[model samples]
Each structure stands twice: as structure tokens, then as C-alpha cells.
Target: MSESLLRVVPTVPDWVPAQDAADAAALVVSAMCPGAGELVACRYAEVTFIDQGANFEAVGCPVCTAPLDGDWWQERMDDAYATRFATLDTVTPCCSATVSLNDLEYHWPAAFARFELQVRNPGRGWLSPDEAAQVSTVLGSTVRQVFSHY
Candidate 1:
């Protein structure tokens, strides 16, 4: 019951933003499902506007990047999605037991700022909880900027 998320190769290049190697190609991972029609397409981010062999790419800021070690990657993977992204002081995972984007807030709920999520029955790509959170961040920022006049 996960959303259709996309999957891409996990590698970074000189032109791509190296924000946290872990996230270098995470979006591509999720895109696999969406592209294949597993999840509904709420938003889409194309990295570098170039489709490599198969997958697309996304660019993060330099500040988000860091030299990685196995331990750090595993630890971040273990940590709640929100915690890793926002460095939240507290975290709580949503076990709603169903795939529904209806609950997603227009604004980030302070409590789940750094939590992770797994979309169900992806028609296209698979967005891990943290990747989903980042998706929200991008969507929210874009929405606010575009509709500021409203």
C-alpha cells in the first residue's frame, strides 16, 4: 500500500550538489515508484534536468553535505526521518496503518519535523520517511514563494 515512488542510482557527480552523500540520489530511489505508477504524483523534482542512463537527479545545498562513514549513514537511517532533517529535539513516528496523504499538513507539524515515512502501494517511486519530509520542505517553500501575493 505504498505510493508509486521512483528509484534512481545512488551516486553523486561534480555538478550535483553533495548535500549529505546519503541523500545524493535518494530522490531517484523514490522516483522509481512514481514513474511506474505506484503513488500519486503530488510533486516532482528533476535533478540537473538531465536523465542519466535512466534516473533523474536532485541538487542539495553544500551545507547539507558531509563526509560520510558507514556508522553515520546507518545511524541516520535508523534515526526518525524528521530528526535527521531538522535535528528535532523530539520525534514520534506515525503508525496510522494506512496510506493516506490527507493528514499531511500544509505546514510541517512541529512534533514530526524529523520523522520518516513509507508510502504504501507505489504506482511509481518509494519515498522513505525522510525523503518524504524533504519533499514537503521543497513543496512548501515553492508554494509560499509562488503564492506570496495571495
Candidate 2:
């Protein structure tokens, strides 16, 4: 059976205190996915890609909204991974606009982050903007949610 995950990550790929992460996770569970178990907070040594698993559809340039070539995106991802994601800067092939890979328009809202709060089988829809803002307040940073199915 497939399970859904709701991953909350900071808007910027920066670190936050473990307590802050735990508080954010607790907030999401209590206010939204009360039945959700396996809540976890993670902090990576470096920025890492947090994808939406099989939910991913397409990615596009944030500037021109042109559909990005998969091969080109992969190449850029590889280059960034080589540096442990220290940099996500790239030039969009469509408009030659310089932007961060993290800023791309992803269909399922993927992101790069050093910290994440994940709830497995959340049993609820996406968080409301108000709820997300509450989580953001708890974490002291703006947050984005990534829904993943696997």
C-alpha cells in the first residue's frame, strides 16, 4: 500500500534548532494530522534535496515558466550535489535567467533544506496557509510543505 508523507521544510536551506523542528512537527500533528504517527525531525549536515517522491511531475523556469529539459535539470542537480549543495545557482536555458535550483517552479513543490519535519501517513490534506504560517512561526522561518506518496 502506498503511504503519503507531508514534509515541512524551511524556505531557506538553513539550520534550525532541534527543539524548533520538534515544535513545528508537533504543531502539524496536533492541529492537522492527529492520527499521524512516525513524526520525525531531521537535520542534515548540508543542504539536501527534499523531493515529492512519485508525486513529482515537471519542473519549469521560475522566470519564463518554460518547461525545463529533464536532462538539463539532472545535470545541474549533479553539479550541485558535487558541492554538497553548497550552491544551487544556475542559468535557465529558456531565458538565461540566473536563479537558484531551489527557486524553480516544481509541480509538486520540491525544495532544498538542511532541516525537515516529516509526518508519515498524515491522513489529511495539505496544510492551510494559516497552519503553515503557524509552523513557520514556531520554527522562526517561513516554511513550505511537500507532499509525497510512495
Candidate 3:
């Protein structure tokens, strides 16, 4: 079976409470986008690496936009799985510039430990900036949105 999720996670990942996440998620449903009513059925959850699946692939360098090699991608996935803080420094093959792995984008929704608010089957769209900002405000920390499938 395939499922789609709209996840709101605190950027710090360590300071969010499940109750706050739940409340923020409810606010997202009421104040966000058009299809956000779908979020009403969702709940709060803790995020983990296992949520990544084999879809855990890294993208290009955030600076030069050079695609990562297979070995580099594997190394990134390994680090993500093994470390609590998944940031890493690697040289880009194209520009030879050093970049933080956190700076690079990902092909899939990477897991964030601590807390996340998950909206299952949130119809067919993403959250607006205002909605995200509201969640961030409620959580008392910066937050990010992640879309995932399983």
C-alpha cells in the first residue's frame, strides 16, 4: 500500500512536545490550504530513521548543484542512519567546494528525531507559508515541512 504524509517537524527536533504538535496540526487543518481538511484525520508522532526506507537518497551539492556520486550518496545515507546529528562535510566533485550535508537537499523525506506532526492523506497539496509559520510559532521553534510516501 502507498500512503502520503505531510509532516511538520521542529528544526531543532529536541524541543517539541507531542501535545503542541497535535495542536499545531489542528491549527494547520483549520487555517492552512484548501485541501487541509484532510489533515483532520492525522496525528502527532515521533520521527525516526526507519521512516526513510530505501528511498533515502541524497541530492546535489547545495552550492554548485553537482549531482552526488553513488558512493557519496551511500555515505550520506549511512551517516544519516548512524548519527543523531546527521550533518556532514564533504567536498563537491564538481567545484571541489566543501559543503555540509545538511546544506544539501534530499530525494526523500529524511527523518527528524524528537517530534513531528503528521497529516495522512492531506489530499493533494502542501502547506502555505502562513500555516507553517503558525506551527513554528506554536512549537516555539523553527519548523520544516516534509512530504513522505510509504
Candidate 1: where are CA atoms >4 Å away? 1-39, 42-61, 64-66, 81-140, 143-150
My TM-score estimates for the predictions, one after another, are: 0.20, 0.93, 0.67
Candidate order (lDDT): 2, 3, 1
The candidate with the higher TM-score, 1 or 2, is 2
lDDT for 81 in candidate 1 is 36
TM-score-better candidate, 2 vs 3: 2
Give one digit per residue, the lDDT tens place, for model 3 in 40-141.
Answer: 423224324324444556677667777778687667657755664444456777788876554566676553546666667677666778867777766676
Of the candidates numbered 1 and 3, which has the greater TM-score value?
A: 3
**Error at 120, model 3, angstroms:** 1.2
Model 1, span 30-144: residue lDDT tens: 5534534232222123211111121212211122232224343335334523333223122113321221111122121111111122223344323455654555443331110
Candidate 1's displacement at residue 48, Å, is 23
Regions of candidate 2 where Cα sits further than 4 Å from its true position: 18-21
Two-way lDDT contest, 2 vs 3, winner: 2
Question: For candidate 2, lDDT tens digit of each residue in 1-150?
Answer: 889899988899865556755675566556677878678887888898999999989999999899999899999999999999998999999999999999999998999998888889987878899888888777778888899988
Candidate 1's TM-score reads 0.20
Q: Please give the CA lDDT of all the candidate structures.
A: 0.27, 0.86, 0.61
In angstroms, how far off is 109's CA in candidate 1?
A: 24
Model 2 lowest lDDT segment of ten: 20-29
lDDT of 2: 0.86
